[model samples]
Every structure is written in structure tokens, then in C-alpha cells.
Target: MGQSSSTMSSPVIIPAAARHTATLIFLHGLGDTGHGWASAMAAIRPPYVKVICPTAESMSVTLNAGFVMPSWFDLISLDPNGPEDRAGIEKATNFVHGLIEEELKNGIEASRIAVGGFSQGGGLAIHAALQYPKSLAGIIGLSCWLPLHKDFPKEAKGNLTTRLFQAHGSADPVVPFHWGAETSALLKQFMENSEFKTYPGLSHSSGEQEMEDVKKFLQEVLPDN
Candidate 1:
């Protein structure tokens, strides 16, 4: 598989308001590209802090019968205890970490950059934030799971200061409610104010009301204008 780059082509959404104090790094789900979730960015709001949606290196997913797809990892199932490609997950984590590093090198401070995603993207966000060296503006995951079932890194308890806003659709047939419950509980076991919202009757995709919730969460997590 091709290794990830410090910079990748992304579909970006720039807020017309003044220069943003922070940049939001948006990662897409399995089988989806950077541009796939550009739809969600629309409801995100005005004076847009810069939003960067990056595409993953294309690869085969055994779960998808070896079909090459843009993904953070090959997810075998939404079950928290299901099979996973640990190596693939680690590589993806490194790639995401590299993206964050590149952004910092380009002038966005660690505290001013927020990393987030949907489904598999959400899983990766949790993975990198826990492993990150410093606190970030925030982390968001919509209909996602934890990357692995392993114990949280000991350093994670102390290093993680990033505020988490996790939202899951109660009707999400892919990822079950239990997964979101456990993930949220796990976060609370580690950090202060790791927030979780279960959208009643919502399905795999976010609806307008839920999307508005995301906007509110982002605005709350981001620094004041």
C-alpha cells in the first residue's frame, strides 16, 4: 500500500468570516473519499474556521472482499469485539498524526486544530487524540467506534486534554448502540467532560436536527471569535 503524505489533496471549505483561529481536520469513512462528507460541512456554519477534509490512501478491504477503497482501516464489523487489522489501524493513525503535524508546521498550533470524522473516521480520531502529545481544540466522531479493544496508553490519561463530542444514531444499523455506550464510558474513565449524544431514531446518516447539534458542538468546542 502507498504510504500517506504530509500533504494530500483535499476538498476544503473556507468560512467567509475573518481568518479562523483554528482549523478543523475532517476525515471520511471507509469506502468514502475526502469529498464524500463535504455534505456535512454545509451545516457546520459561517465565519467558517478552515475545514480540511483529506482522502485516505486507497487500499483493499478484506471485509469488502479485497475491494480497494479509501478507508482508515478495514473494519470487519461494528461490534466492539469484532476482528480488526491492527497494523492497518496503526498505519492510518500515523498518517493522521502526520496530517496534524503538517498543519502545525504550516502555522496552526496544536491547541488550535481539531481532528474529527464519521464512522471509521471517528474511530481514527479517538485513536490519534489519545496518542497525541498535546491537547487539541476538540475531537468529533459521528457514528463511530474505538479503533481497538486494547487498554488506553498510560500516557493517554495525562496527555489527553482534547474535548470529545461523540454522536451516534440510535438507529444506526452498522454500529450498534452498545459500541457508542462503551466508547463514551471509556472516555469518561479517562478524561473530564468527554461528551456523548445518542440521537434517538436517527439512522446511519445525520439528519438536519442532528447536524445542527454538530454545529453547536463545534461552536462550543472552538474558541470564541
Candidate 2:
């Protein structure tokens, strides 16, 4: 599928109370804006970590029958193994990479940064972060699967020490648990540390237990001073 022009607004930012030493760029899923996840960021982020949530541009999604919504890329097909949207994925990756660069320019080292997302956003997180040029602190994927899986072996670079935390609901209908587990397995080949967790009767959304796991992952990877 063809991609649209690159456009972005000022991200919804939750700044740290003290001097910032780390950054987390979290992306929201399809049909959702950055604001939707702002409160979650506020709750889970560490005291010295600033969170950056960028709003995906509104676009017509093919799977949604051309309905306009905020999406990182066009969901061309619901089939997990169908041909992926390479163009749209590349565009979103560049956009997210820009955000990481901006943080780096502001003095946060790549080692102190993490990128994460949920559902569609989570797919992009694992896809892009593995291919990102610099090593990051962590990669968080919640209730989401990996996209462009085959391309990783050829295009993946950096972030060897970066830990990956992927959690999926075994009962999730949107992104199946098997897919998440498979992605986590593939990630283990590239990352030195990777963890995968499954919530027994949970659905496509996150809950307190998942958040607690995420909090622990963040603390272990990007601890506050």
C-alpha cells in the first residue's frame, strides 16, 4: 500500500519533576491519539524520566474500510501473515527515529532511552527499535506482535544490550499470544536480554498486573538516580 505525506504535531509530553536523565517514547495504537496514553505514562514512568507520546497523523485505514483515524500506518490486512505495509512502516520508523534523535540532541544518551507501544503501536516499537541505529535502554511491547519479522535478520543493528519486554494476553483476540511469543523468541536471537510474559485470561488491553511488570522492567533497564 502507498504511504501518505509525513506530518506531525507537537507531542504530548509528560516532563520529569527533577533533572531528566532518561526518556521514554510511547506510541498509541490505531484510532488513538498520544493523549490517550499520557496518563498511563504519568503513572508508570520514573521520577527522572520524561515521556514523549507523539500523535499519529489522521489517515484512511484500509482495514477499517477507509475510515479516517489516527494511525501509525495503514492496516492493509488483518491476517497476521499477510503482506505488511512496508512504506507506512518505514515512514513511522523515521518519525519515531526523529523523536529519539531529538532526545539525544537534548542530551539524553541512547543508552538511557526506551521506546514502546501498545497493539499497533507495539508492533512498530519492536520493528523499529531493533533496526534503530543506536542502542536503547529498552523496548516494551504490550498486547502486540511483531511486524516485518522476516526483515529483521537483514536490517537489524545496534541495541545489542537493550532489553526487550513483550507481554501478551493469552486470550487476546486482536494479536494472538502465539505471535507475541514467536516474536519474543526471534528477539532473543538479537538482544542479549529479552523477557516475554502472558496473562492467563486477559484480552487485548493491559491491566494492573501488566503495568506492574512493565514498571519493573523500566526500573531494571532505566533506573532513576
The CA lDDT of each predicted structure is: 0.76, 0.87
Per-residue lDDT tens digits for candidate 2, residues 1-225, read 444454566799999867999999999998988998888877988889999998998889899999999988888887767987888898888888989999999999999999999999998988889779888999999988778888766788766567888899999988778888888888888777888898999998888999988888888889876
Error of 1 at 96 (Å): 1.4
Predicted candidate 1 versus true structure: per-residue lDDT over 49-163, tens digit per residue: 6777878877777777889777777767645677888888888888778878877887778887788889888888888788777678888888887887465745463336568
Backbone clashes in model 2, listed as residue pairs:
none
Which of the numbered candidates is closest to the native, going by highest lDDT? 2
Residue 194 shift from truth in candidate 1, angstroms: 0.8
What TM-score, to 2 decimals, does candidate 2 have?
0.94
Per-model RMSD to reference: 2.5, 1.8
- Clash counts for all predictions: 0, 0
Worst 10 residues of 1 by lDDT: 7-16
User: What is the TM-score of each predicted model, taking all chains together?
Assistant: 0.88, 0.94
